[model samples]
Target: MRRNVIGSVEQMTGLQVVEVNIDVTDLQLPEDDEQHPLHDGTRRVR
Candidate 1:
């Protein structure tokens, strides 16, 4: 994933990428999705 992302950025922008950083803040399970109701093209951040 990191390699692909870097390669895509370099290819599109013609800039050399030095590094990539990733931070995972939240994880949603299948059960969670089922429990929560879907919104109509709206998003909530907490």
Candidate 2:
């Protein structure tokens, strides 16, 4: 469902989506928790 939405936005705006990131910072631990932030939460197109 998410992929289709992003693809539609890209097609409509003619702007390519450089990346798709999904993160869960709230669920991270202090012990060597190396995870990227959430970009999936963002649905805005360029």
Off by over 4 Å in 2: 19-46
Q: Residue-wise lDDT of candidate 1 within 12-45, one digit each (tens)?
A: 9999999999666766665676566673344568
Query: Model 1, stretches more than 4 Å misplaced?
Result: 25-46
Clashes of each: 0, 0
lDDT, candidate 1, at 32: 72
**Could you say which candidate leads in lDDT?**
1
For model 1 the local lDDT of residue 5 reads 87
lDDT of each: 0.77, 0.61
- Number of backbone clashes in candidate 1: 0
